[model samples]
Target: MKPDTSTIDIRAMALLIILCASWGLNQVAIKAAVADIPPVLQAGIRSMGATCLMLVWMTIKKKSLLEKDGTLLWGLICGLLFSAEFVLIYWGLEFTNASRSTIFLNTSPFVVALGAHLFIRAEYLSRIQIIGMVLAFAGILVAFHESLNLPDSGMIKGDIMLMGAAVFWGATTVVIKASPLAKVYPGKVLLYQLGVSAVILPVASIFLGEPPVQALTPLVISSLIYQTVWVAFFTYVTWFWLIRTYPVSRLAPFTFLTPLFGVLAGSWLLGETVTIYLLCALAMVGAGIYLVNRR
Candidate 1:
């Protein structure tokens, strides 16, 4: 429970698995609804809904929403980075398969691991961990190779955009670890992100000339609700807690599992392609993550 701990206990592992599973499926949820709702508009609405939920949860907990804390500047910076991440992700999903998007986006751990090493004095990667990072990243390179060679050029574009989002996400983690936001309430940290993105994304949707609402099928609405309530609001709060409670380097390895779950979810739900190459990449990434965690 202490902050900056080097090891992950059983409770953290269990919650992390659950988080990865939900996140993996989250890509599928976005894709499922993409046909009915435009991507940026969908993301905007999800952020708005999740922001409302964040407000209510904080209010019920007697947390002050308007505290004049020093975190405002860093918090807004985090929010802007968070906004950029989702904008790219939702837009990327339009061009690539959910499985591919997941594979590329989860590369944030590399970004986090390296950034933490450079910025946070308490967090440094060991030689084994560095090796683990390379192996895991090699897996990503394998999948990325397939993307570039695909006849569909749009897939390459989407994959690159998702990778860009990974940088933003990784930067967000580093900022939270290195800045004043680390001392603030986790929900409020999330609130800053959700609130800022709620306004920016909808405006983005409008500025981009995306229609407000094209179709509202039951499944699409359910997907939006699930994204808003569970993935964005609840699980992300838990993620911030984990970040505050554990070493960022130690927590980085576990994210490799997310793409596996996402690939499976995409295969089952959207019938997206899943090649043996991707499976091999998953295996290598798993081994690499294990090495990173090994003492």
Candidate 2:
């Protein structure tokens, strides 16, 4: 059965905002955990933990884990993309600050919108959408204004990886839109992707000489719990619910707030400096979101 496409409710908007905000703060948590744990291992545990929880959820809901339909192939492809996205993001964090990472990560919108236009005929971008995309891109640049000025900080490489991660994320979005897995329940889709990522990341960590237990600490555990439970499972489920329940176009613009929240959370939690550039970037992104949402 297809989800109802009707009015966007206030609760959905609130949930979207909360999800974005939680995700924004989640970057800081992951960053903090990295100091006490290897990035890859941390990512692995987060995925594994979330996967386990999702499995329990599936069991409770009587949802089948195995897909009999052709959507299984799409699910695997989507999972591979998801795994690669986090692999880049987690590893890139080792080379860059959370704020800079957030900036580069926001580029996903551009990539996704472009991919959508090319592959999914349903998602044609209007002039306003194009302009909004550009503005959001500018906002990302603004968010990293200070870092851009420092050419000596080895930011070039980190920025590249972060940008690559964003591309992968965009590719995943395209895959989702085009793949038959789109017909599956979001929870089941997430479970499979997380399960795949959980398996892939840990093996990769081992191959990279990063043992799972070597990074285990109290801080690491707490961060993993938070990342798995709140960031991965809860936020994702809530966002999916909103998308399934509300007018997708009306709610889509709120996604731009995530990196803004990331910057703010990074500052508050990690004591990262928030500069005028970030403020300007926030304005630009907010305006871009408004434009994108305007019918």
Candidate 3:
């Protein structure tokens, strides 16, 4: 593992951009594919497929999934949180545009930061961090301002669901960081979540009465491949590697680019309207994320 450093070289920056773009495009792919495969079912399939791929990679690298000492309990907790987060994300996408959902989903950092501050003594928040949190919340309000004015909107429901997803995502992070799972290899930690989610999400889909696949078009197949290979497997591994090699504070601010890419990709691929309000809100959220991650 590379020693943590404040400097982000050109290569690292380029890789970060690629990672963000891949993640941003993932939302668009999910939105397009969910029409054919019910969102929950689609998520389950992707998780299972990714788990298989992860197993192969781990085998090739001679990494032991069982190396984590006493992590089973925390691993299961993280897995459940991961499963819940994706369920809400996929379900929320069914009711709202990808751009809007992506914006709300990015709020996970704010949630994670807050949780860390409250639970981890080492992560106590400074005044600037508090201000960043307030700004982030303000941005969320701005993004949903119109929807809030109109009662009982599908967009409102979708936004709320996405927010719920962000909460779960943040909670998962806290669990991993606070528990014995943090002592394990990143791949092992990921395997626990992927392996457990593979089972949980499918069962949840069945219980939720998600319908069978409507059709398996080329686009749907391609989206599934992308989600399984690129988004869930490769990018995740790359992200873990990057964080291990660099200062997380340096790498984290670049994540704000993800929602920007998400918004642009949604407009380009799905023809979602980019309202002025959304742009203003994105700016606020981006600034807040930068502040929160700043040293």
Model 1 residue runs over 4 Å out of place are 1-4, 92-104, 142-145, 150-160, 271-275
Candidate No. with top lDDT: 1
Each model's lDDT comes to: 0.84, 0.74, 0.76
- C-alpha lDDT of residue 161 in model 3: 94
* Candidate 3 residue lDDT tens string, 149-253: 443588889889998998898777666666676567778778888999999889888887889889999999999999999988888767766654554434544
Which residue segments of model 3 deviate by more than 4 Å? 1-17, 91-107, 136-145, 153-162, 240-257
Query: Which 10-residue span in candidate 2 carries the lowest summed lDDT?
Result: 243-252
Clashing pairs in model 1?
none
Which candidate ranks first by TM-score, i.e. highest?
1
Q: Per-residue lDDT for 23 in model 1?
A: 87
What lDDT is obtained when candidate 2 is compared to the true structure?
A: 0.74
Candidate 2, position 96, lDDT: 82
Residue 245 CA error for candidate 2 (Å)? 6.1
